[model samples]
Target: MTYSGDVTSGGAPAVRELDRLTITKVSVGPMDNNAYLLRCRDTGEQVLIDAANEAPRLVELVGDGGLAAVVTTHRHMDHWVALEEVVVKTGARPLVHADDADGLPIDAETLTDGDTVAVGGCSLEVIHLKGHTPGSIALLYRDPAGTPHLFTGDSLFPGGVGNTDQDPERFGQLIDDVEHKLFDRLPDETWFYPGHGKDSTLGAERPSVPQWRARGW
Candidate 1:
């Protein structure tokens, strides 16, 4: 089936295929966190975006091919509830931003703003969008044959930026980084997957940048 990017908690995943990689998005946990399973066609190597919840299910999704790493987008507990179990089951490396590493249940490979995380031969550019958390990061995978795909963990969503606890400074920082690092650099056609709920393209959310800024959400 074609990739729709719409998934429900406990429902089926939405799969999108590119020339070199395949992305499978599944919604898990009570918060309805979205975990992405990326497979490299050339190497059969896989990496999971977040082990949010349902360890058994996530391990099942991983299967015997083994997981290279489990990337926790931020320090949010809702995003890494199953990280320990999933890692125990698959021995996948844990990767997270430096600021949020202490919040995780286990030690993680600290990532900097411009660090690159690879899934087989595919390289994911890490964009650090601070404010929602001190260590929030998004993964950018530019398809060789098509537009870019972004996995934004609670940073840039369909409607607005991530929650900043109603703090004006935090909100300002997040919006600015998101606009500069993401909107300003990436094209409108870039397809983005959020930490929760459905997916959308930069084109679909670009016009609302001013409104999101004005409202400070």
Candidate 2:
């Protein structure tokens, strides 16, 4: 089926097929957290974006391909509720930003800005985006045959940057990071998968950046 990026808790996942990789998105937890499984088309090597919630379902989602790693987007509790259990079952190495590594249940391999993570023959470039959490990150995969795809974690969504609890400093930091690190660097064709809810292209949300900053969300 076509990928719409629309999913509900306990519902079927939406799969996006790329030239070299396949992205499967699942919605989990009461918070409607989204977990993505990226599988290399050539090698079948897979990496999960977040454990989120529903350990059994996530394990089932992995199936026989086996997981290479689990990358936690940030240090928030909602994003890692099933992290430890998922890792225990899959034996996948847990990866996270260095600043948020100390907050996870198990020890995770720390990543920094510009670090490259391998997914079989494919690799993802890590983008460290601060404010949502000290180490919130986004993974970017530049598809050779097509456009770019990004896993933005909680740092970005369609409407605005991630929550900063109405703090001006935190909001400014997040918007700045998002604008320069993401918008300025990525092309408009970039399709982004957020931590929750629907997916959107950078071009679709580009016009509203100024409004989001003005509203101070």
Candidate 3:
């Protein structure tokens, strides 16, 4: 089930193999939201993160392997614009955190922190990171080779944390979760894929945690 060469489709770029897993990254819609297709190479079963936009293109990407589920990192409209269409086309179940489930346009299965979603032979552990939205969640995949990959939705980005309202409490929660659940526990090589822009490693962003807190964004 090894896929070589360029797996890029439409304008989306592929990240190729991260150990045994295959990750394809697609940027869609006006907001340039990032949609990811994570495939379990051993079984070909896959899950999509943030159906963002462009149903036709997304359906094409799903292909014959089919989709096991579609996960919405948060309830943001931009992240789920094509969710309905994609689900209709593939019959994939929708999953989102219980806290933000009410905001989604369609009915979804509630995912709590620590829940594990199986994609073929691989498993993605869910981590609820609050404050980006009450239900903002991140998925952690520990490669067999020991490197870890994190799908952080809009919560943790390359340069800073997700945008929060002016309320000090909300901002504090987001930083705390990121520090404890992510930076403190994960290794430096953990690769973080965000909902937009570029990917970054924990080591690259770790040194600036103090600065991020002082700025209060």
Best by lDDT: 2
**Model 1: per-residue lDDT, tens digit, 5-92?**
9999999888888999999999997999999999998999999998999999999998988999999999989999999999998989
Candidates' lDDT values, in order? 0.94, 0.95, 0.90
Models sorted by TM-score, best on top: 1, 2, 3
Model 3: worst 10 consecutive residues (lDDT sum): 1-10
Clashing pairs in 3: none
> What TM-score should be assigned to candidate 3?
0.94
Tell me the tens digit of each residue's lDDT in model 2 across 1-217.
7789999998999999999999999999799999999999999999999999999999999998899999999999899999999899999999999999988989999999999999998999999999998999999999999999999999999988999999899899999999998999999999999999999999999999999999999
Per-prediction backbone clash count: 0, 0, 0
TM-score of each: 0.99, 0.98, 0.94
User: What number of backbone clashes does candidate 1 have, counting pairs of residues 3 or more apart or in separate chains?
Assistant: 0
Off by over 4 Å in 3: 1-10
